[model samples]
Target: MTANGTGINGVNGAAPAQAHQAYQYSKEPLGNPRPIRIVVIGCGVSGIAAVKMFKDRFHNLPVELALYERNKSVGEPGSRTVTQGNPYFSRVYVGAPELYEYFKGRADAYGVPDYVRLEHKVTDVSWNEKMGQYGLKIEDLATGKTITDHAEVVINSTGILNAWKWPDIPGIHTFKGTLLHSANYDTSADLDGKVIATFITPELALDLAPKGRDTVYSREEQDKWAEDPEEFLKFRKRATHILNTGFEVIVKDSKEQKETLAMIKKQMEKRLSKKKELIPKLIPDFALGCRRFTPGDGYLEALCEDNVTVRITDIKEIVPDGVITSDGEKVELDALICATGFNTGYLGVSVAKFPNYFMTTGPAAPAAHGTFIPCIEAYIKYAFDAVERLMREGIKSICVKEEAVADFQEHKDNIVHDFVWTSTCRSWYKNGTVDGKVWGPWPGSGPHFLESLAHPRWEDYDFKYRTGNRFQYLGNGRTIRELEGGDLSWFIKKGPKHTREELTPSTVSINGL
Candidate 1:
């Protein structure tokens, strides 16, 4: 989505110098701060955060926020973490259901649910150039009613894992079994002793299927965490520090990566010692953390079970009641679960051709390197910074310039080329392909991603102001600071951290117009 526009030099360029004269106001000061209508799609963590930010920061302004969510209630919208088998303890560390509650809880705590339009699915969104607004086609899931809405600003907080795809295979429909996509799994379907063939692995059912590993913390430890708030905070900080500092292990050809890989390989090989043949077939050859690496607790032991059979053969096709291997062996299965994958995206706060649009958690975000919470907050703040600029400057539309997007992409590609994610391996990071661009991770570590978005470069955007000129916001060569009760000396440094009640030996002030 390449857009052609000048940053601040061409026809749409900004010029503070109003050659003719300054704007003169009639009634109000700052002359009616342009009323902005903002629409948010997807009530995920990002969407919820956007609403909370609006309440916290955009208050007392003419900003209207409407959030549309597809689900009955707010929850974490998308990801690999939602469907992975065995609920890995170290990586894929938390349960999907629990994660859902956490996100929903955050929103509920902030009263963000009040602003949400639940059961409202956004079917399509497009920017109307003439109107200078984004038009959204929405469908209410409850009544099957469709609606069209427009907003001056649109935020797509819908994370990448929303779109799930079935693996393209011949005669897949012929399989006479309960087929399921991980994103749309039916929990009621009984998998007890059923011969399940999975593209990835099975779901929570396998978490404790006789051959399971249970990790239990001591009662005293639990009480300590529950009783002492400081203790819990300390633990969280320690865990975050570890995850953040371990970025070197994902660096291409780094000593840390090599050492970490060897340690994990030895541990996995030991776990699979009973069924040694599976080691060669299951163990990866690529760099560690290249794919979604999880400690599959009891997975190896389950494979060692009597009924468990491992097949590394390619699937020729699926016939009635079974799958035909490339080696002419037909394996029977009661169910087929395609944990195939989702359509990831190349995302930044704004994209070309989409004016006044923002994405909270997109494919290009720093997802894999460490904890995602900080990054999500950073993304929201970065996006709203631009929004604030538009509001303050009375801008109608602001789109990231084509050159800036191109440069960011180039830098991202170059940096990713040296990361483990871009190694020769089939991964969702590369859009479920073996050899393509890495789409699901930022170019650098999570901190780097956060740092990059810390400040927005104003010159990287092309903006069209509401009054048709950038200087229109200059507003009559007068400021509200000149009005009664306004702090005229706010620019001066406060005495000793604002300790002084008044300036010492104060001189009489004059009101000059």
Candidate 2:
């Protein structure tokens, strides 16, 4: 059959007509001929991952990528605290160093090390709409030199925990004892002979008040996990299952909550049997799992020492020698430790005024539940995918629609109401907000968040392309493979076949037919 002088089927067929008349092959090279600039702030895991993704995916493309780190090293911001041998509070399922090494190794493998600028902080980010680029003011801490740089895109990987906030107790500086925040807490060696008093809220107090046992894995087991993939998968499945049980209890039903509370109480009772009087002060009156649970592991036992004391009362002020309680009772101490916590609600992403800016560990990130590495990986993928789309389309600028953000926040707010994190309890998750806003938790399963981020809706973004027309990205009626003398019928080449057969309708289930 012939239509419009083109044959539908036969050994020979006429070429298809051009779809648009305005399409002129400008005689210029196709595929982003101009260089694309990308600047990533914060050299943490998220930033490193972003850099690696961009390098791996767009190596052939003309792209310029730079990573700025405020600290002296890549993992200095958060890893400094972890390097002190204080095992991560959450169940990481893998060694902390192993994860750090993975990120660093990937960065090195992708040639990211050469592009990183250490001790260079991004003080300000301003977009020049006239030039369709972002201008950043960077300050080098070591040399004390300030410079201005421009980029087509910017990624903010500054973690939420970067900002540490101290509790506002009066006369805290008056204490003659050594004072330090938990973020700067190096070792327990100095507290060997000194009277050390660590001030913490009820949420943290519960975790530290109980003397729990640490799960120590043998070096052989670690080697086995590293060498044997199947063994590691099995171990991960079991660990995740155990962690999910707590999530279910806190977010789903109260029966499990009561049971878990009773079990914890029994354990605490047995552990502190000799000092039963401390149980009432240690066990919180609120529901269990309302806040992030830390495996105390020997913390309560340390408090039972003759020189140690777990003061339950609030601090009224800091006296010359020690802390003064709310009841005006003085507790003599040689050192004070603030286990207070970091500030939240800073979504490292772009503000309404700034467009084409993205953040990884922002307030909207899913952090309250599950391991953070996976969440960081998901967010990185989401942001980088958008960047890739921008580059492919030759888009000058793109910003997430306000409606999309609002919809996401609304969904988060609705789902968090069912979780224990929304319960009436003070914690870092809320960031001292009394409006009942839960900022930390993702309000969904880790897998759910990962899956949702896998496919970002392009419609939720407003784009500005190189050409005025949005459909200019449709490009000439030809592809790179066609221009490069590649196989035109490559799509028809078959390679491998699956063992399972495709699904077919059964003859027995033909009633509808």
Candidate 3:
């Protein structure tokens, strides 16, 4: 029910409600332009968007924008990876089309070319009160050389997945075969005839098996067995393991293997039979939506291949050339693909250490509500909040309201317990210090998040505007009144709901809703 109303639980769909607005004031003509140098810490979607926005908005001013990245090219570990094909087409969010259009428009409007100082890894950040800026020390990941940069503002868009964490299973090093995380899963061609085991999340079941088994028992028969719990469980267990679409082999002791396969097949059948009923209860043992669901076009189908085996065995540790399970069995894997994901080093300390910088863009930490929507929503809020802070105060530089940072973290911690998703202990999204306790952001819905970020909340942040700078925040008491207003309001002040146009891929043209 929550999902239906919210469209997706956590996504905020209605237009953003109003907060206290900033007071607007007119200023006299500016004299000389002030120089503002900004350093954006990553070249991913967030960094690129921020750079372009700055160029377009502050083109006439003495503003210098520099982007630094550790990857040689754009779209590194955390960047947008566009997968081609009809199957992968839907992976890109619907909100992405608008984003593309926005970026394209900004690029065209400003002559600033996107530049990245690639192969640079940021090592440390130190605060300098004398300079009123944060100093960043970085190491060139390629050559191992150190570099430093200081700017009026520093944005850490250096996203999650920058570092990978491996399971601390003993004898892991002894396993002679290749061991890699899921991030290293580049292709499936190597899985041709070798036996491979993979850990798959239940969310990926649809992608794994798109079609029902050809030899499955009829629903009528299944329903008959369902009358008895013990009988049904035993039967279903058999069905979940066996059926596959690949080559079959017959060995001398294959009877036991056959039975094992049959059990898995039966279990899978039972799982599918109860899909609708289980949707509400299907929470992961770990956090439900913590780590991103590893999605591939045909990962499930690949697992169904005869040579590939899906196991739920609890791993003990890695043995030379194989893996040992808690059940006292050893699996010999040639290459260990660590499909395990990364560790997000979410700092628990206050962002106050960084001077003059305010939270004006995205979540200071990682937040994955529904990929694109909430990210944009939260980022925009930060943007408007910063602008409003500047408008209210005459001071040019301001940092995140120290109080808001604490409140925001406390708020984030409180939400971690309410949702079943956060109840799971296993997740990269959890607080680095606490288990089953997530310090990361709560996932919000895309549409809802967009509406929330539409308005600026001036009172929510601590801001100090600078009179030394030529720019000032200009605010009108527009109480985010667009959502409640009817057709009359649309006529009065042409709102985005009426005038917002979709950007087409071909030419820059507005297509109305």
Candidate 4:
């Protein structure tokens, strides 16, 4: 982890040979006479990656970059705590290595701040066409000071976990012991010896559980273990029992969608009739893989500890001291942790949420293949190659082609259909609308994701200005200055020299394993 001379070469142990080649700009040192003012919102994985890429590629080129985060530090919000604790499950799971390699160089050059203001909350966004800029209205949570940030380019990488969704159960707030959400879960020490009931599905259960721990395997593994039918049956029954007790799933019928519900009900009847034992396994009341996998490491094992109990019953209401179940029984508890996940179908500032894409076939998008898309790796490679080609021809900011979305989704749908895991149980992955429209850009596979982000393609989008003016290409020639323009001469100025210091470990932790 030694800091290399160049900003982008070091950090996270990336292979030197694979360091990203810096992108060269065209005729004008910068396309416009003004400094490219870029504002990045949220300091999560994607936001950090985008900012670092811009800095590494176009360092000291009159680029004013600012990042706004609601949290106090980078990688502390959402699932960041989970990933930092368990790298094996997260590193490859979410394409972290690719992000690391992409952003490392820039972080070395301009190190990220350790702490930021955590009290500001943005309420509204407005675009000022006359000023040719965007405005974000925010309120300071502590001081109540209202402030606005105006910028030319604003990136909304606010992430998916900012909002939490609660399940609508009758009289939930009426009887309460100590109800809380999983978002606040920082440590398992408090639950070391406590009764815990998880109202979640199998897909979500897997995420909360340890790695490689599942209720049952697919047919391939079943066949391998079936040599001893008697033993295998015992294990199978135990696994099913584990699933039932591991989490108290509130099997909400998918009848919310009348057509799909009727179809599922008909299929369930026949399937259940043929094999009653398979009822719990095959027919999930909620659609399978509609949510994220909820990981609860040390949760079930904690139940075996003293002074702990696990209940699998419908919740009736929250009473003062305990929870009343629909089965006419009340369970006494000290506290209750609601590991109820998040809502995914509708994201704020979403392209679908706002009709801003109407200018052309669509608004400007980053080349599709280079994002997190798994199935379109080859297409991403083609896209990145085009970006390099375009860079040679003097084009800097490349937008994704509108048609690429359709093309990418076509492959995503195919990948979804071929996945056996998708048919396992209901969760957030399929949190699509009743009409079956996807929300995010890509599926959940790392290799495919890396391939997709490998490069940019110029043909996919109509690269143009967000402002209502045609950009004049000067091809690396230094442009005539506008009043508020940033000067490249500042980069050439001699910076203050500093002595190198020996690196030392700052702190140690038990969870660093």
Candidate 5:
């Protein structure tokens, strides 16, 4: 996950005119400055990306970067954390296995181990106004020691899924059965030939249930799907069709919603034809795409198994042997799995009240609508751009403007109304908000988010200069290459340049008007 090359011109090539104007306020040169201290919390994909971005962009500069992970390894104790033992989970490109490999490779290639501190959990983060920096208190989980550190910049990449909450059910402790959350679940060996009952909504139930034994793709088939462009494209097209249809059903008219449901019913009927009676109990009554769409796979088929059962009734209590439902029915079960979803209230990128303290993958992040890798890549680029500005301008602190945040929230609120996430359904996107505020899902397409992140809105930030003068960063008006006696004629070298294309309206008559 490399940056999309949007900030290269601002950093390496000529600065844009707006940037020049922003620098014009600087009064003095940034002479012999101290190394910028940056602390990144969490060693997941986003945190690793932050480390990689800082290293790639400012390796030669005076920058001290530190990364801390609470888990024993880089990725961690969550379901998405892929260790060597479990190399695969989820089919998305940014799934655990792929991300673990990608970030780990980059970390090794860039020698990031020198700055990485595994098993170090950031316990608290607070602003030290007196020191004009962020104070971080970290607990060394392995050594049982506390460490205090200060940083000019702090990045929180502890993703939303880090904190897992179990469903609130009475007498849960009394249950003698093997109970576990989906996050702790790995292989299905324990579930084999057992009476299993999962407490989950329709979306998650469909995702976890085994579709059918034959539906499992062979290694060679999966390899072919990855290797062949045409096959991949066909798969993408089908997926896109389904996603688009789901979106239409949620946002469009009742008629279209009914038609889409009928279509889905037909497909479900074909898959679970033998257990037709279970269709009404398993399928959702709400509109499609109202909540996140979980791939059904062989879920319908699994429910049809004689030993397994799908219970949509609410759980009243957990008994010694099984679960008691709202209808006073006690179902005997050897195992109880809680497949309830994660807390999504905090889903987008956010700046803590303190300046220069930023977090990623929180509410309103573009990952809600697209592949997470690209979205994380975009955020890294955006965050680094701000950091670069701070370094170049001799700025002491930079914080997001209140108006900018308010405006962004307003825009997000308005856009979700046009999407299915605004429908009357309880989901992670809604974050339990009664007002129907969508905390997840980007308002636009993936590419749109990428384009939007191409440049940071510099005006949307308030900066404090080291010298108490904003123009202090306009450093002697000399490039680093020129100052260091490097190749001065490099700009004269032949290269492809951006040329403006002029557009003219066609003069042809329209329908002989």
Candidate 6:
């Protein structure tokens, strides 16, 4: 469709011939901004940051907000959305408890808890055409009752890691040993002298003690960071710069990818010196960055223990004793842990029919790389900018054009194969399909993603006005900004700079010609 398909004219996509119905407005003054009710789902990192933005960063806007989180407390029940690591931390690794405390503290600091509805789950949402708002069906988990609510805007941040999945192995539930899924692990389970099998990281299958774990900050270093803010800022900048610019590393044959492949192979081989036979099984043949990679401080050494047995073959069945391999061997164990990863499909979810809202950190976003917080913050800012326009202007509904989304999808798909995620490795980014669509990340670098979203394409959206006469929002020939004592002449600017001779002798030059 062409750009003129927005149907911006009067009723029936046609303009009036004359002053139809005498302007259809009373010419009242455009007073203070209208109140907008915004509902945010999931209180993970995205939800917390969104709340902070609404409550603290955008206090001036007339916004009514509510945050719905499924978890009753800060941490528990699937661990929600914490993932990956950052370099700027005092240590490279961060635990779930620390992240939970950090978000909890922010919730208290900004008084976000006041607007949070804990233990509430949003089951369904649809547009209420009559009321010009969104209708939501919510489930109160504690009461087992469904409730109904309405909001002008809904921001879904439920995150992708909430759903834990198990491998589709036959007779999986027939095992007699204590079975565990990493996402829903039981902390009280005892494994002191019993054999354990793991389908994920090797360290989880054994009691092999790590030789050394030094991912903590020294006393002096911590003191220095506390004493000098500049040092901290410098370190943060350096780390963020590296993270923001490392997008090229995922390119299939890029120099960075080759270097990373060599480095990872060297690290793994050195750690597995005693058991060289396991190297071929553990080391992946595909290029690096095709899947999520971490430093894994002590994971390699833990796998080198004498008692540890690493299996890479496909599972045939889950016998009463243990897992049966395709090669006809049954490995006995007292416990089994399945770190089979999450059902990450929700991370990049998109619903075409839904209106008056958009996803943050969604598919085709730069979220798959870099420090995720920056990406989350950027997306929130972008989403709220639309929310501001909807509240400030007399807009009934606004959503991206179908053609625009199609174009974006086609463009992203054209360039996605250049990255490592589309290589010969199975990844959650592709929903575990080796050749499936890549939807979890932007096709460019982190900075490029930020810059592109900094300026929203207002024309790419279809905006429906609240009034019959589109110009009714002009209202009394006075704007809210002007009423708030802003500079009335702000739109006026000096003309282009001209030479003195050209400005003074225009008449003489005409006469001579």
lDDT of each: 0.72, 0.66, 0.47, 0.43, 0.65, 0.70
What tens digits encode model 1's per-residue C-alpha lDDT throughout 194-228? 99887663232233233224454456655787898
Write model 6 residue lDDT over 1-513, tens digit each, in one string. 011233332333223335555656536557556778888888777777888788765587788888787778632313322233433344555544445666677678867778888999888877765455887888999999998888888887776567778878898899999998877777689988999987773322222223245466667866787789899778778777877677778898999889889998998888778889978877888878777663355566767787787777888999889988999998888988887666765433233435567677567766567667777777788778888877767776676666677887898888888888888777777877778888767888878888888878867776667765656666787777677888776755555566776576553343224
Candidate 5: 10-residue stretch with minimal lDDT: 1-10
Whole-structure CA lDDT of model 3: 0.47
Cα lDDT for residue 332, candidate 3 = 77
TM-score of each: 0.85, 0.81, 0.59, 0.54, 0.78, 0.85
User: lDDT per residue, candidate 3, 289-317, as tens digits?
Assistant: 33443332333344445454556667888
Give the clash total for candidate 4. Answer: 40
lDDT of 4 by residue, 138-168 (tens): 7777787888776544555565555566556
Q: Which segments of candidate 5 are over 4 A away from where they belong?
A: 1-34, 76-112, 186-189, 211-250, 254-262, 432-436, 476-479, 493-513
Residue 166 C-alpha lDDT in model 3: 66
Report the alpha-carbon TM-score of model 1 versus the true structure: 0.85
Better of 3 and 5 by lDDT: 5
- The weakest ten consecutive residues by lDDT in model 1 span 82-91
What value of lDDT does candidate 5 attain over all alpha carbons? Answer: 0.65
Q: What's model 1's overall lDDT?
A: 0.72
Q: What does candidate 1 score in Cα RMSD to the true structure?
A: 5.3
Task: Output candidate 5 Cα RMSD.
Answer: 9.1
Decide which is better by lDDT, 1 or 4: 1
TM-score of 4: 0.54
Name model 1 segments beyond 4 Å from true: 1-12, 15-27, 77-92, 201-231, 481-513
lDDT of 2 by residue, 1-513 (tens): 001112211111112333564654434334434576889898887777777777677777777889899887675334311111212223323333455565567667767778889999999887776566888899999999998888877888878777777779898888887887765554453766788788876444433343334355566777787889899888877766665545566763577877887887777766666567777777666666677553244555665666565666888888889888899888888988787777765573444335567778787566655556667877777766767766766666676656677887888788878777777777667886533677766667666767777887777666655554445555675666767787776555443333345334532223333
